[model samples]
Target: MRIGIVNDMPMAVELLRRLVVSTREHQVAWIATNGREAVEACRRDLPDLILMDLAMPEMDGVEATRKIMAETPCSILLVTASIEANVAGVYEAMGHGALDAVDIPSVGIAGNASSQSARLLTNKIAMIGKLVRDAPSRASGRISVATDPSPQRLVAIGASAGGPAAVAKVLSAFPIDFGGAIVLVQHLDAQFIPGLADWLGQHTPLPIRAAQEKDRPQAGTVLVASSDDHLVFKSAQQLGYTSSPKDNVYRPSVDVFFESAAQWWPGSVIGVLLTGMGRDGARGLRQLRDKGHLTIAQDEATSAVYGMPKAAAAIGAAVDILPLSAIGLRIIEACGRPT
Candidate 1:
């Protein structure tokens, strides 16, 4: 991968340069001292991926990520000094389409250039590479549906790219007595799932947590996919994980979970496809619609990346294509209110 480095600190830039060049699969494309420079450099010569730092002189990473994604869209990984300290900003940047975040790794003694953090960065880059190189292609396998009656209503959501904040905003609107069981399939690393749930729990009235193995989605609570493997329904009412489609680049794929819900969930369903970079949820959402479930897709004007929802709209999968603000109320209208 041709990687770009963006940081104001000279030492940080040098260290990132060394780190990026350490592996034979990667090469340094260009360097930017600030967010503004990074955006400009991207316009002139965009790289395969960028290592973006949060704090800088002219512009910060959050703004740069927003600008870059809005103007010249590309892959960005937030390589900041302290992810713990910048948790809010990290998600904010992600809301604007940054793929993921990681703290800068320490340099080894005498410039040895080897550490656990180094390995971590390498692994993150490798995963992001797969996401960029491998777009979602549909498989031919079919999952069987159950005919048994289950009284639980369901709300299944899929998101990526700029999903964190969007999901938070939508979930925040659901009242405490919200009637439908909620499940989220966001494109993220397994390590970040708990943090994402905790962060979301803070903003929403609903209880939020990572979905455990064999857990069933319950009303008035949110369950998130907790593993890198695809979250699925083993039975009509039993949740489980599977690695059957190993070729998918998006771990915890939305399509897998949504399709599982479409096939298995017996009650009323509302499928929502939020902002994302790819078309993972579009096909699954279509399946849900074909089953006569109410489906919603975020409109392109309000979407950060607009790829997933746009695909949904293109195929006439969404029953209502709405802005982010309008989606929650629609779900509440369908799920919270009894007809």
Candidate 2:
């Protein structure tokens, strides 16, 4: 894959160059000292992917991402010195189309720190490469609805990247007495789950909490997957976590949860794939659609990173391709609620 590097610090740029060259599977296509240069470079010659620094002199990563995407779209991964410190900027960039974020690996660290960081960056790059390769020819498969279309009682949502805000928007649209259970699988670091839950709860009328082992999902409540393990269902009401799909890159995978729901949930189910990077929820959303459940994917205009829903739509997994604002109302109607 051809990768571009953007950072203000000379040393950081050199380190990233070394890291990319060391991989051998990828090549450094170009280098930019700041956001302005990065945007100009992208317009001239767009790389398959970009390693963008969050903080830079003059234009910042967020603005660069916005411009590059608006002009010459490409996959972007935020490579920053401090992820915690730049959390807001990271999300902002993602909201504007950046795929994901990772801490820049420190060269001076001892022990296995360097190796661990290298592994993380390589894995992310490899994932992005696959997304780029498959994006162009992706086909949305046939949308199959259940012949009987059971009464909707469960809603399963999956999102990553710009998910927190998107999830909140959908959840907030529900009334306090929403007569169904909501299972949300968001790709986020484990440490941030509590804070994300609190943030989403603040915007929604339904009570929101992280899923607990052996807990049954209750109507009128939202269960956010909390663990690093994939969240799945043991039965119609019971939720469980597993490390069985240890090879899968995404933890608390949206695919895992949606597939489990297709098997366990007896009633009509509503599956939603929101703004996110990669194709994690695409296959699972298809599974739900094949089972006759209503499946929705966020349209590109409203999606922060359109990868997941794009994949879903490409492969015919989504029964409806709607904007983010319309999803909640669609869910409510699917659940037999009046418009």
Q: What C-alpha lDDT values do all the predictions have?
A: 0.85, 0.82
TM per candidate comes to 0.88, 0.83
Q: Backbone clashes in each candidate structure, one number apiece?
A: 0, 9
Off by over 4 Å in 2: 109-113, 136-152, 198-202, 205-207, 336-339
Report how far off residue 308 is in candidate 2 (Å).
Answer: 2.7
Lowest summed lDDT window (length 10), candidate 2: 138-147
221-255 per-residue lDDT for model 2 (tens digits) = 78999998999999876889999799777787999
Off by over 4 Å in 1: 22-25, 110-112, 134-151, 336-339
Candidate 1: worst-modelled 10 consecutive residues by lDDT: 137-146
lDDT score for candidate 2 against the true structure: 0.82
Against the true structure, candidate 2 reaches a TM-score of 0.83
User: Which candidate tops TM-score?
Assistant: 1
